[model samples]
Target: MQAFTNADMSDKGATKPGFAISAWPDTRDILARLYDLANKEPVLAIKREQMERYLGYFEHKCIKSKSMTSAAMELIPGGVQHNLAFNHPFPLAIKKAEAAYLWDVDGNRYIDFLQAGGPTVLGSNYAPVQEKVIELIRECGPVTGLFHEYELKLAEIINHYMPSVEVFRMLATGTEAVMGAIRAARTFTGKAKVIKMGGAYHGWSDQMVFGMRIPGIGALESHGIPAGCYEHTQECFPNDIEALAAMLKNNEAQGGTAAVILEPLGPESGTRPVIYEFNACVRKLCDEYGTLLIFDEVVTGFRMGLGGAQGFFGVKPDLTVFGKCVAGGYPAAGGVGGRRDVMQCFAAGLQGLKKRAMVGGTLSANPLSCAAGYFSIKAMAETDAPIKAGKAGDRLTAGLKEIIKRRDLPFVAFNHGSICHLETAAAMLMDINNPKIFTEVSERKHVMEEMGAAFTAEGIISLAGSRLYTSMADSDAVIDDALDRFDRVLGSVEKKK
Candidate 1:
């Protein structure tokens, strides 16, 4: 074995002190063209060891993310299910996701700001929902398209809370519900065309995939999307009442418009904030023109609390599409809830069990999903979980805001209840020293890579370049822990300056 002294290694190991970076603006750009001199493969089995090593030197530690990411690519396609999870190296693989934290396979824990992208609003493996699921599964049946008590229970729960829902039905996914909402609206109004907000993501269904954002710019599709299939979904910008009004008028004149759909609070529009006046104005227009307005609440539904986003904002829509929080972080759940007149179209065919609507999923209203959803909502109401989660979101984001401000860093953050996220375009703009110069899509992407690695090292798992959600299970202590780690990792990103 060889033993080395500080002076010996310092003299021979690295370049002399005060070596300048020559003017590299971003750490990512530098990392991009650089290669390691040593074999990093040895680092793979040593993460748990590395974490211990760091903790020995300091009181805190986290995963490197690089090793875990490479491992993920071998197991899962793109290293994740959600589109935003396709970060630079690749997303870290989860060993476990419980409560408000994720443990990567490398054994590093992260405060789960991603919150399973929102379905885990109550947090992963919530006790009440889990208990209910197990109890129901053992006692009776988990799936029965014939009918189940939980489905009706689920319907009544939704009807009791949302003002717009007089009658409703459930499905297995948000896209199913959203597409059903569109189909029902057209059937009820006898119209063939629909309008959708630009940059809003309803689902992966072909019809609704039109006009999505590609690095903050609206396009028919990014890749693997057919222009012809999405042609009927006329795109309008969020919060742009004028553009909306014009589109509605033109469609009405053309006599083909049936419905208008949007994410009530879209995170994809590059943080274009929605105002009270704008939503209220939209409601008035919907009523005046007899156009059915659909609030695609996949990200907002139970997440905005018992009343969801419509009630939270004091603006009700004719039809509402829900998912995410409804399933309590489980598989198979979503639904369309709304006015009796529109829903009646779906109710038409059943005798005692008539089916008026064309939407049907073998898993639609399955007992398993219904039981999960019922328990999720009940848990929120009973524990005041939504409010608690919102507070968590507020604290986490507020801390992040303070850190950015104190560091004089540029970034934007906004929250819709417990769901919160950061947009790093401002951060990139600041780094470029000119907001105007942060124009390229590639610049924003480069920044995402840096943030992902930094957050992973800080014991926090975030989404995309800049997005996160607070779960009800995150108490103040958990929030503080994440914030402290965030503070340190951000400092590291800066030191790499």
Candidate 2:
């Protein structure tokens, strides 16, 4: 099959494809130039000053949020439940969220760019989805510890959109889904070692967390994890086909590779992007090595398109791990889907299956989550939320690019559908092979934190101060307002320089 590219989709330049197959060259060029500009001393100083101003503003405007965060720290470690919750000054204690806006405890309002960490592609507390969820709760309740029709419906919708998924099984979180996908690959191939792209996050399972964040640092974050847990996990550079082939060849000599897994959009949701034909290249390599290719579409699944990245890229994988938008912005959103033979690993009491991965979650395929997922997919299809949100992302990207150019700032802005990334500290894309990896990350920590604070101060919420996920609710007007805020922040930083 021909490798998918921006030209494959009708809306080529308007919105980048989920897999970024065609846009890789331009993306790489821009990233290289931005990285060079960001590393300059003057640029770093200006970013530092901007961060201080925004963080100070946050401190002044969010007194109530500050108090709540302090109280939360007593009960919750780091004063936040999730990594995304802790912002620059202090995590905002949100009182309510609707559509594309959030209200903090201080009654301050901000445009919602985090999109609930990429789950709420339809927007946070989207009314139609909430209406369905509420109605389901009132009728049959949340769970029955038994079967529910919604499970079947949800599976059907997923299969409809993602044809590679001949069978499906739900899990509670993306991490569980990754663990299950890896287990299935290993079981089906009867192989040991698994190869994942460097800097790709495939959830926090002990085995899958081998190369967290920075690549080449084997199990550096494996604090309590036994060394044996990741003995078979190997890493390869993103978009480097020869490196993958070498790893697979070495693994074959070692014990054979079970699976070649990756986030289709490259590591950290395209922070480290791959070339246009990277997915197709990897697919060929996996086939040659008799290794399963698993696409961790937790962030790109439903949001990318109805067909997800696999469909967008026109390259099917042996297994697919899904999360976020898959659950329809509800809690407990994760699942594994793929060929029936391989997916049978998760089945119980099936003697015909030569191997079993033994995967199950008590809350897996629960009624409420499935219901939300089913209706969510239905809503997405009817409204074309993915395409609409992608357009919104396109507008946001264009606006940010314009802002950067106008302010003469060294930054990069781009999007894969509604998943927009604004990269300032391009230096953070650390060279995994470098011995000074820890120092590299530590030196830029303050600047990164400050950028995030500046966004928050300007009434914008983002993922880690770098990435922003737009939603279907982000209409032209909403995006324009967001652009104005972005312009303010960009201008502030540029003036400091």
Which candidate comes out best when scored by lDDT?
Answer: 2
Candidate 1 error regions (>4 Å): 1-81, 214-219, 222-225, 267-270, 348-356, 426-439, 493-497
Query: Model 1 over residues 1-497: C-alpha lDDT tens digits?
Result: 11222122211111111111111122222112111101110111112343344334212332445566667668978666666566544455567878987786567767888777778877888887899999998977677567888888988888887878888788888889988999898888877678876656778787777666522333435467666666677777555677777777777767757888877654242133344345556677677677898988887777767787777656789899988767777778688989988888777355574335588888778888888988898887877777778778788878987886776544445554566656544322221222333354355455555566556655677776467777778999998988898776554433212
Q: What residue pairs are clashing in model 1?
A: 346-356, 346-357, 348-356, 349-354, 349-355, 349-356, 350-353, 350-354, 350-355, 351-354
Highest TM-score: give the candidate number: 2
Q: How close is candidate 1 to the true structure, as a TM-score?
A: 0.80
Task: Please give the range of 10 consecutive residues that has the lowest summed lDDT in model 2.
Answer: 6-15
Model 2 spans > 4 angstroms off: 1-25, 34-53, 350-354, 433-436, 494-497
lDDT of 1 at 251: 76
* Model 1, residue 141: C-alpha shift (Å): 4.3
184-218 in candidate 2: lDDT tens per residue? 98888889899998778888889988776666766
Model 1: residue 293 alpha-carbon error in angstroms: 0.6
